[model samples]
Target: MLNAITITQIYVPDQDQALDFYVGKLGFEVTNDMQFGPMRWLTVALPGQPDRALLLEKPGPPSMSEETAAQVRELITKGAAGGHLFFRCDDAYKTHAELKAKGVEITEEPVDQPYGIDFGLRDPFGNHIRIAQMKLG
Candidate 1:
């Protein structure tokens, strides 16, 4: 039986920059840093959360098809289109401000939703992304 998906791979141009975003801005816990030859394997997870992790690694040779390159670059540039992290918070308004104070980009402001508060932004690498805090009954 498959228990769960443990990690996700995100292609980035700069490993350090991505680390800063996932760690410094998003407050994810660092897991491992392994370097072998020209490859570096760094993984991080959210505090108190370990079932999933973010894999920061370089993309394939740029010589790949322009279309594929465009898609990867788009994922890197805008943030993961399908990446959504849920944060449990007391106040979404304060969370938004805190992120702004950290110089984190706020591509969209918080808006009330049937399920909760949803707003999100991109890391410097452009992974389509968001953070949400679900509302109560």
Candidate 2:
């Protein structure tokens, strides 16, 4: 049986830009950055979480047809291609301020929700990310 999720992939138009956004801005650490033939293997993980990671990939042929890749590209540009990534933070308000100060694009400011205080943002590739602080039960 599978024990845990190791890596999740998010397609991007450019890996270099994604790297800068995730590592330079979001404060994730680089787990791997190497070129395998025509494809580059780029992965990042949170500084405190070493097991799970996110892979920054480029849409292309072989795995997806050229037409399909183009469609995905368009969707990504429209911010409707991928699912949101939810992150649990200690303080949503503070995190939002810090990320915003660092030039990260925040789509929504922190607000109280039934579950917690949360905020939303988009990665450079247009992937949605929601950070929240869970209320103690």
Candidate 3:
């Protein structure tokens, strides 16, 4: 039975840049960084959450043909790759301000919702991310 999600993958054009953005900008910690033949396995997880990690994968070679990889890269750059991440924070306003101060792009300002406060942003690779401070039951 599938009990827990272990890892999720998002295609990135460059692993190093993605690493810097996810770690340096978003404050995610590196969970794994190793090379396997032509592929580099890189993963990052939020602090204190190593049970689930996000794989910063490059769409190429072992995964797909060069032609297909090129197409995927184009789609990713256009923000049409459909890569999205949703995160929960203790304080959405504070988190948004902190990320903005770090020079991370803020696509939307925090706004209150029925669920709580939330905002949207984009990763360097055009992946959409939303952070929220959810209301507790």
Best by lDDT: 3
lDDT of 1 at 116: 90
In model 3, the runs with Cα more than 4 Å from the true position are none
Ranking of candidates on lDDT, top first: 3, 2, 1
TM-score: model 1 vs. ground truth: 0.79
lDDT scores of the candidates, listed in order: 0.76, 0.89, 0.94
Q: Which is superior by TM-score, 2 or 3?
A: 3
- Model 3 scores what on Cα lDDT? 0.94
Off by over 4 Å in 1: 61-71, 78-90
**How many steric overlaps are in each model, in order?**
10, 0, 0
Model 3, 67: alpha-carbon shift in Å?
0.9
Instruction: For residues 1-137, write the lDDT of model 1, one tens digit per residue.
Output: 98898987767768898888989987888887897555778889988777788887666443456577667776656555444544567777888899999999898999998889878777787765666778777
Candidate 2, residues 1-137, lDDT tens digits: the string is 98999999889989999989989998999999998666788899999786899988888855688899899999998999965788998988889999999999899989999999999999987899999999999
Badly placed stretches (over 4 Å) of model 2 are none
Which is the winner by lDDT between candidate 1 and candidate 3?
3
Question: Which has the better lDDT: candidate 2, or candidate 3?
Answer: 3
